[model samples]
Target: MTVALMWEARAVPGRAAELLAWTEERARELTERPLRRETFRAPQDRVLVITWWDAPYDADLPELPEPADDLTARPVHRWRFESLGSV
Candidate 1:
């Protein structure tokens, strides 16, 4: 089963760009690479990341951590999903 992990964070005012860069750097240093990875930005200073893995949900993987207190207005949020085959 393929697992998709979504990570999201809301940056403080005027810090979206920095936060995005931080996440990008962290992604590069992951101990275990994902099958695929992508990132997106929202209009209101939010950043989103999606990482796909061939391992099951319970497998251990390097996860994105929260940005420093000064960088984000709130803590990061994460969710996991399992892919379903087409009908």
Candidate 2:
């Protein structure tokens, strides 16, 4: 089975760059490597990261942690999805 983890966050005001940098740094420092990883950004200072792992849906996997309070507008959002076969 394959699992895809999604982590999204919104930066505080003008701190989007700093928050994105922090997220990238933390993702790189993870001890376990994922099958695939990607980062994205959107309007309203939102950032999203998706990591794919070759493990069961409930398997333990390293995930990006929350940035400092001043860096984010609110708590981070995360989700997990089991991958279906690609078309």
Candidate 3:
């Protein structure tokens, strides 16, 4: 099975760049390499990171951590999904 972990955060008014850098650094520092990892940006200064792993849906996997409170406008959001295969 393949599992994709999603980590999303919205940065404070002017800290989007810093948040992105922090997220990228943390993703790079993950001890275990995933099948694939990608980062994205969206409106409202939100940053999203997705890491795909070849493991069970409930398996433990490395994930990005929340940034400093001052850097984020709200608590980070995360979700885990089991891939259903591409069309």
Candidate 4:
């Protein structure tokens, strides 16, 4: 079954752009895996990262590269989803 993972974080003021750029580059490198789709969004002070995977696997996806010191607060929220047919 296809699965989707959502990662979200709050960027410190002007750090959203930098975090998005870094995540984009890192996400591209994961194309060789089950990754089917990926995108990043910056709304207000929050950055959202969404990725779709073809199937559940134990492989670890690429991590976002380091951002500027103090660019964002530590810890991020993540959610995983499994497609349950069309709603």
Candidate 5:
């Protein structure tokens, strides 16, 4: 099965660029993992981080830096797909 992890969060009012840079770095790091596939989309005031990986593989979601309280974090939602047929 393929697993997808979705996370949404709001960046500080004027820190969109900073958030993008931070996520880029994290994505680069995540790519080093054999089963990791990650991408991001920013819409309105939220950032959508989507990651796909093998069912049993481990994934490290990027951790916010110090001053972590600056951005609001949302609960993560995960789904597992048995096949890619419907996607």
Candidate 6:
């Protein structure tokens, strides 16, 4: 089954640009190509990265590490989902 990894972070006030740059760097660290991936940002400094892979949900894969505490308002959040069916 294909799996989707969602990694999210919220930067400290006015640090969204820094957080986005940091996550962009992490995306380049992938060991293999994903089926598709996307990154999004919200007005409140929230950043989200979603990467789809051609592997099982539990498959070992590279993941983003926690960013500097000073750059984030809180710890990062991650979740995995398996594709059910396409619309």
Each candidate: RMSD: 1.4, 0.6, 0.6, 2.8, 4.5, 0.9
Those runs of model 5 whose alpha carbons end farther than 4 Å from true positions after fitting are 31-38, 56-67, 71-84
Q: Model-by-model lDDT, in order?
A: 0.92, 0.95, 0.95, 0.67, 0.52, 0.92
What is the C-alpha lDDT profile of model 5 across 22-79, one tens digit per residue?
A: 6566656653342445556566445555665565435453332322556444333344
Q: On a 0 to 100 scale, what is the lDDT of residue 58 in model 5?
A: 51
Per-residue CA lDDT of model 1 for 22-66, tens digit only, reads 999999988999999999999879999999999877888788988
- Write down the worst ten-residue block by lDDT for model 2: 59-68
lDDT by residue (54-74, candidate 3, tens digit) is 999999898888799999999
**Clash number for candidate 2:** 0
All candidates: TM-score: 0.94, 0.97, 0.97, 0.70, 0.57, 0.94
Error of 6 at 25 (Å): 1.2
User: Relative to the unseen true structure, what is the C-alpha lDDT of residue 69 in candidate 5, on a scale of 0 to 100?
Assistant: 53
Residue 22, model 1: lDDT of 99
Predicted candidate 4 versus true structure: per-residue lDDT over 1-87, tens digit per residue: 677777777777777887777667676776455456566575666777777677664435544454555766656777778878677
| Candidate 5 global lDDT | 0.52
Collision pairs in model 2: none
- Provide the global lDDT of candidate 1 against the true structure: 0.92
Which clashing pairs does model 3 show? none
Q: Which 10 successive residues of model 5 have the least lDDT summed?
A: 59-68
Model 1 — TM-score against the truth?
A: 0.94
Q: Write the per-residue lDDT of candidate 6 for residues 1-87, one digit (tens) a residue.
A: 899999999999999999999999989898887889899999889999999988977899787789999999999999999999799
